[model samples]
Target: MDKILINVLKEVQDNDGYISEKAMKNISVKYNVPLAKLYGVATFYAMFKIEKQGEHIIEICGSPSCMLNNGQKIEDFLEKELKIEVGKTTKNKKFSLYKTSCIGCCDEAPAMLMDGKPYTNLTIEKIKKILKKY
Candidate 1:
């Protein structure tokens, strides 16, 4: 039941982009789960975001391998460009920056996932161009 609960929370996040208080109440009533228990589950997992996200989700690889290959520089550049610290959504809700561990692109090192699409071998110039598209 615990595992299934996680799956259901994931479904809500997928469809709604984030878990809302109203949705949590609906889940609690529909699943016979306590609202507190549901909130605990939602907050326990980093993958479960309660607050709404920006239009573009940028997850930069923060693995050691990536860091050794200019990942930190890329992360810094992104923060500067976006003018918001990691884990924060921009004021306009256009972009959200986050640091995530290995995305299995060590060989490609210094990579990022923009809206779930892998963008590898990044450079300041490349990122600038990429951001322009969004």
Candidate 2:
């Protein structure tokens, strides 16, 4: 059941970019899993987004290596440029900002994932250019 739940949730997220409350209820009824339990499971995993997301997901690494390499500064730059804070989606739904513990790019330190593509050794200028492309 756990494996099934994981697959079901993944399918929902892949299709909608998030798990809506209506979807959760449907899953709960179909799988005979309690709604509260489903919510708890979804909220417990960082990979699960229960709310609506934007067209693009921007995930920045905030691990020790990334922080040492000015990841915070990059996050600040994005917040200012996008006019949205972390964990928030752009008003136009074009982008969503997130800070992740790591993105397996510690070798690159200040690395980021844009729409699942990796960008390493970021600078404010580079961020600006990247944003332009999105």
Candidate 3:
């Protein structure tokens, strides 16, 4: 059941960019699992998104290594440029900014995942350039 739930949630995420509350309830009814249980599964996993996201996602790492490498500066730059805080999507729904612990790029220290593609050794100039591409 857990596997099925994960698969279904992934499908919803792939199609909707999030798992809407209505969808969760529908899945609960179909699977005979409590709504709370479904939500638990969703929230427990970092991959599952409950709220709405944008067309593009920017996930910046906040691990110790990243923090030491001016990761906060990168986050600040993104917030200023996008005018949205972490866990928020742009008003136009074009981009979303998020923070994560580690992305297995500790060797690079400061790193980010833009739409699931890794960008390492981030700098303000580089981030601005990357945003332009998106």
Candidate 4:
């Protein structure tokens, strides 16, 4: 990992998963790294979540192409099955549901990314399997 990212992780970990903007600015100044560069790195990786995440982050693609392929249905299923709404974590905080735009995997419409792993052609059964792995 990059030194800056490691430090950022440490800071976030120390603060219960949130990295304040003030802290980010401090990191930039202390490390002599550009703010824009740090921001870019933070935004570039789906894994680097700027906000707090639960133990598992479930990201469902909701682009037009995906929507046409029952993406909404999948989202609904997830909500109903997991008993949580998008942007909300589960009661146990083991999982968080997030609806994203395009994941650039339209060929696998109605797909979801679970903790950075892409699971395509999602079905309730498939989702169960994925959840089991977590």
Candidate 5:
């Protein structure tokens, strides 16, 4: 990581893995980077979490291609099985669900990413197995 990013990570670590607006502003000023640029970087990558994530981050691809298949079904299954809505963390804080645009693997429609690892061509059974691994 860059010095600036290391500093940012330290700051986030101090605040329970969440970067507050004030901290971001301070970083922008200290690093001489534009606030918009910092925010853009934070939002551009799925790995740079803005909010506090659970132990596991489950990202479902909901692009048109994925949706045309069984994306919705998979999403519904996750929500129902996890007992949490999209963008929400599980009650046990073990998982957080997010809907994302195409993860660049449309060939694997109805795919999901768990903590940055892509799992494609998912069925309920496969999803269950994947979750068990977590």
Candidate 6:
């Protein structure tokens, strides 16, 4: 049942871009699940977004390895360059920034997931170039 609930949530998020309060109610009624339970599941997973996101989502790695390799520096750069704080979308809606746990690129460190594509071994210069293309 947990797997089924997660799958349904994933499908809804994929189709709707985010999980809205109305959707949660619908899911609750349809599945006969408690709203709190559904909300808990959605919030527990990093992949589930409760708010609308920008065209490009930038999830900075917050692992110790990434931090040691200057991930904090990269995150600061992204916040400045994008002119928006983490967990927010830019005014132009072109990008959104977030801090997430390791993306399984500890080997590369300083890594991030942009629209689910991994960008590794980051530096300010490399990120500037990457943002330009996006």
Q: Tell me the TM-score of each prediction against the true structure.
A: 0.87, 0.90, 0.87, 0.65, 0.69, 0.85
Q: Write the per-residue lDDT of candidate 4 for residues 92-125, one digit (tens) a residue.
A: 8799999888888899888888988888988778
Q: Of models 5 and 6, which has the larger TM-score?
A: 6
Off by over 4 Å in 5: 1-16, 20-50
Identify the leading candidate in terms of TM-score. 2
Query: Which rank order by TM-score, best down to worst?
Result: 2, 3, 1, 6, 5, 4
Q: Quote the positional error of residue 115 for candidate 4 in Å.
A: 0.8
Candidate 6, TM-score vs. the true structure?
0.85
Error of 6 at 103 (Å): 3.0
Clashing pairs in 1: none
RMSD, every candidate, angstroms: 1.8, 1.5, 1.7, 5.5, 4.6, 1.9
Better of 1 and 2 by lDDT: 1
Candidate 2 per-residue lDDT, tens place, 21-93, comes to 9999999999999999899889888899998999899999989999999999999999999999999999999
lDDT of 3 at 35: 98
What is residue 60's positional error in candidate 5, in angstroms? 0.2
For model 1, residues 1-134, the per-residue Cα lDDT tens digits are 77988999999999999999999999999999999999999998989988889999999999998999999999999999999999899999999998999999999989999999999999999999999999
For residue 33, give model 1's deviation from the true position in Å.
3.6
Cα-based lDDT for every prediction: 0.94, 0.93, 0.93, 0.79, 0.83, 0.94
Better of 4 and 6 by lDDT: 6
lDDT tens digits by residue: candidate 3, 81-129: 9999998899999999999989999999799999999999999999989
Clashing pairs in 5: none
List the lowest-lDDT window of 10 residues for candidate 3.
Answer: 46-55
